[model samples]
Target: MGRLTWIGIMVALAAGFSAGAVFGPVLMPRPGAASNPNLIDLSALPDELREKHRNEDFLRNEATNYAHMQEALAQRAAERAARAPLDLPNGMESVPFGLVYKPGGDVHWPEGMTGELGDALEAAKDGWVILNYWASWCGPCVHELPEMGKAAPLYADRGITLIAVNTDPMRKDTPDSARALFASKGIESLAPYVAEGTAVDQMMAAADMTMANVSLPTNIIYAPGGTPYAVFEGGNLSDSPVWTAPQTLAFLDVLAKGE
Candidate 1:
């Protein structure tokens, strides 16, 4: 099958997997829980203690919900692994991958460096490239930012570069918010790129990927010469096991050694 066609299939499968696993009945609130106005019996508690009790309950509920989600995600990942191995396009083993940077788009670096998207990618073509597409609005994307930050230096030592592209629209999702998030998450090592206009759309289209169809926190792994090797989409706990830092590093190691 053609590359785009294969990507379409993968997208469909990922959507189905998410629907079955992440957004299944487990996520539904208990019957009457949402409808009941007095679910919390705080009427007898003192005013000073009521807020504390509510906060404690909120934290407890959050922890439980997060655990359930993680379990579901892990199960989905295992099911995906049992079904098929991650395979790229045929003959892509030799194809040189490179970024199709959209000219006139602004890209910002942590060190206060600013430049066009194409120039930055061209300058960093000497090593394995992990092009991560993210947005501030995506919870999973925000959660993975810190992990990506922590892994960047280690990957850089092994001749790998991690470029985080903020796909938030300039008008609604300001660059300031992106920068703030990077700083808040302590993302020191990963360079940040801001997408302008249809820059992200153009880049994905060139690589036979579509943002609308794929999940957020999408990542494109490119070999040293810029040839795209793998496209991993969805949350960190996604069925695509390559979403983890270890898996990503292992994949990069294989590419770096030409294995």
Candidate 2:
């Protein structure tokens, strides 16, 4: 094969590997999945290419298995909830969420999030969408990230998309840094979304909520059809109404079953 021809083959394989990393881990894509048009004809690739393809498929299957395990664990947690419902702790507001989803409010999507969420939120409109604000400097945010990550697979079960918007870009919070943090913590279920110039104001507007003296590190939940469902303002989950990851898994299970 000519030099350039070999290069083309490698390039195609690289693309497949990267694509596989994204959708493969969660969706558990098969090499011959009918919808995958970009999948190369592996039968023709040299031994090296074939080996890499096999490794990629192995990794993808492993990720899918891990996600399934988390989901099964989540199902068990739901059973526990059925036996004994979770009660709002003292000092926590009785409201299902700090803020209830209001109808027809004008939600100002942050500039970058608009195009992304326009499609994502709409597609997930039939299920659930979770938006969170976080920064590396915030201790609580960092602590909560892993917890949220743990529940992410469960959340994704019913068309859910969890987005954590990074803050303090001016203070040197970049997407890469956030990703590094997540990677360090063994978090694969969610990715850090960069929302430039996003503040409490922008996030509040994005969730179609008015400023109610809430601060950063806000957590907002959306019900099916992209409607604002609830907002759990910042605080330590252990000490506040913000549901812990396990609690949320149970809640989402109950929700998906319409119980």
Candidate 3:
């Protein structure tokens, strides 16, 4: 055979081998689950381009799960909402006290203090004293003050004394505003006083150290002997779920009739 003829035969053989190898995978794309054009139509890509996009969707999903950006954003929003300000008292800017419950109806008063309030607290008598620490700018105090005003008169004959302490930290406009607000609202029953100088700080310190850290609108109950019965550190009287209608009546009952 001529040399050119041999070379042509070899070339022809190589072409046939290449055609079979290419068609082998095309005939069977791994058997199970036939590729549906409507589902994942990849007819548009050449062989080299097809594999790149084959895992594109899977990679995108993996990246999303890895970052979890959407979930992080949602959590951040919730935190911000929770941190939003509540109506604080004038000259103050924090929720220093938390809710606390005392069992068995006993109150522990500050040692070495003796006065009307001190006497009432120590006696554990049926009568109850409510020490309300508030400020002019506090929204929660404003909301609760009216309820207290009404309740005070209603229970006046029952020996329930409502003392309102203004914890404005300074004799600024805040305390003045608070007093005016109370007067205008006809809160005549409250024994109002400005807790200026060190009084406010002292009370807060006492609460934190001895009385279970309390705040404005704090309702502390005592037995006749000056022992703490219960303490309610919450928002407006209407908003605090700690005292129910029946509980309120019961508390009043103890105050009015207990000795």
Candidate 4:
């Protein structure tokens, strides 16, 4: 069978494995299920089965998840490569969500954004920038924040930077508060930058977007050379994107490279 066919089979099997996690393996600090929602409750198993299969099941489930994720990534990458755009002004252009390609130009940040958040954006102008907006009150933002932090490191290797800016309105919005929140959430790898002072309206204006078109959990994407776009806006926990997922990394790699 061809490689794509093999990947398809593996993905299907992974779905089955994930569904059968109770009969499969993996555990977490949580009393019952594994940290990954995909895996089932380990503590619920019979005492002997839990003891006998704890390590083995964990290893098996992790290995399978990783392998399946990679296979899916490679298969999708192949399909994406086959459909890459041909025309470009400077021999290249911005591709957003692989949905549309446009002239890749320098993005202009609004003047009001003038601190750590602005500095972070300025420093990463040479590559892809993923600006994620989140507020403490927004349930969906809290759900996806940790996943984004976990994926931040992987993004650096692919020339992408994920800047998760907190817009929590209740607090004074200090650096220490931001760092504290990240620590509380177990997000150590990514920077602790809050954008409370920097209004969402400022960002929307910079991207030429209107309030009618935007909502909470707005993720503003900046293509290489600094073209800006907003997407993945207005979603609840059910719609949250797991940034650490392999498919996410692969899609990012494709977007970051403009390939």
Candidate 5:
């Protein structure tokens, strides 16, 4: 072969090899292949690129699973709500008293009260207390608060006081913003309680509740004499499929009747 002809052939072969290396996965199937041809072979990528792609896939799957879980919880709450006039049996176990902080900023509390949650509970010792943990950033919590406000008066008539404990931590504008939200939603009846410092951690530990893995609303139901009888975790009937205000009220009604 002439030298020029040999050089040209070698260059052509090199170009073909490069093209095949780049597009081979998509164009050709492996022997006895069961793998998806549409999916990129991440193993062939650089270490950093592979890690990035792996992380993206993990996050996508995580989000999907979370969404599915929320839907399931909402369905469950709906089913429970359909069974109206729910009631809790008597002699239910109770949790011990734990401290919570007073709602800060311009929100008002009774005169001469030191804004200690434990003390407030002690004062209302004879009534059923619904201690709701919420935050402004939490969409489900925001949706449920208005409903809770509407139910507050009726609950109070039945000796149940709905106290919303804001769990937004300490921020310059959090309390003001929370108060504004209450005003905007016309939530007049439910007293605002702030979870500050380590109060949230303490309250969660005391109530045996966990919001670590899931960002769901949690409420603690306390029977007369400050005994925490039940802990409702996850979304409310208003937003989530896990819990409903009606169910809570029914349970309280039974408690009020000493059932």
Candidate 6:
């Protein structure tokens, strides 16, 4: 199968895993009732105090609900595990809920890093501009790193500029650690930036949910006008077809031609 085709599969499976995790709550945190210091024993309280204790108990129950939900989810997962293998595609593992990809949102470029990257994009006299959002911790992102690096220089020679927009907030909080990780991984094409003092949720809400996921290696190709032309929503670059698929090169060619 072609690399793009594999990516398509990954996208589907990732979506499925996300759905299951959400509806199933397999990875929820179990907060035992004892963990909540504010939990009240209504039986020991007087009439007036009982009412107040009931309110506290209500809040405590909400907290414990997560724990109870987690326990239920664990039982379900164990039962499923005893059955056949998880039919998920290669290079994909189940992720927590609320991390699936949805589309139609705008890309959130950090204001500080936007100047250089945007300027680079605008400077493209001809050909398309490819902006890749990636992070080191992302598995798929790591897999795509080398190919993207190669593609960047190749596109540059063709008058197209491929700029990797690093969205890892760790760069701000731990510059040394972040830089070391990037350098160790040989991610030279990615320009690191820290999105500080900005709300990622707001930007993502304004942008497409299809672009966001719990997985790594989310890539979006933009045209010269800063509009999205194509998107590889999920899947790691190291997976089947990504390393050798001609379709990968074909898309790069399309970008080179500015189509």
Q: Estimate candidate 1's alpha-carbon lDDT, on a 0 to 1 scale.
A: 0.53
Q: Is candidate 2 or candidate 3 better by TM-score?
A: 2
Better of 1 and 5 by TM-score: 1
TM-scores of the candidates in the order shown: 0.52, 0.49, 0.47, 0.52, 0.51, 0.50
lDDT of 4 at 72: 65
Q: Weakest 10 consecutive residues, lDDT, candidate 6?
A: 1-10
Q: Give the alpha-carbon lDDT of every model.
A: 0.53, 0.53, 0.47, 0.57, 0.51, 0.44
* lDDT (10s digit) by residue, model 3, range 174-239: 456766888888877665566554445565554432121223454555555445655555454345
lDDT of 6 by residue, 14-62 (tens): 2322222222112222455344332323455467644433353443544
Instruction: Give the total clashing residue pairs for model 4.
Output: 0
Tell me the number of clashing residue pairs for each predicted model: 4, 1, 17, 0, 4, 11
Model 6 CA lDDT for position 107: 48
Give candidate 2 regions above 4 Å deviation. 1-122, 169-171, 197-204, 207-214, 237-246
* Model 6 regions more than 4 Å off: 1-115, 124-126, 169-175, 199-206, 209-216, 237-245
Candidate 4 RMSD computed on C-alpha atoms after optimal superposition onto the true structure: 15.8
Query: What number of backbone clashes does candidate 6 have, counting pairs of residues 3 or more apart or in separate chains?
Result: 11
lDDT of 2 by residue, 1-259 (tens): 0000001121232234343333332232466577664444455657775565557565476466555445544653353234322243333334423332332345433333455434554455567777776667666677667767766666787556777776542346776888899999988877666555444346546744332222346566666666665555453544333434345455656556655
Error of 4 at 147 (Å): 0.7
Displacement of residue 162 (Cα, Å) in model 1 is 0.9
lDDT of 5 by residue, 1-259 (tens): 0000001121232232222132222333456778864545556656764554445444355455445545555654464354322123564332111111222122122223235565665577677777776676566677777777877788778887777777543223255677788999888877666655566555545444333322236566666766656544444433432222454456567778877
The better-scoring model by TM-score among 1 and 3 is 1
Residue 175 accuracy (lDDT) in model 6: 42
Question: Candidate 4 lDDT, tens digit per residue, 1-259?
Answer: 0000111322443443343444433443456534665455556667875564456666577567756666666764464345424343333343322233221232244446667777887888778888766656566667666777778889988889888876543345567876777889999878877755446556645543433322345566677666664344433354334566555666676676666
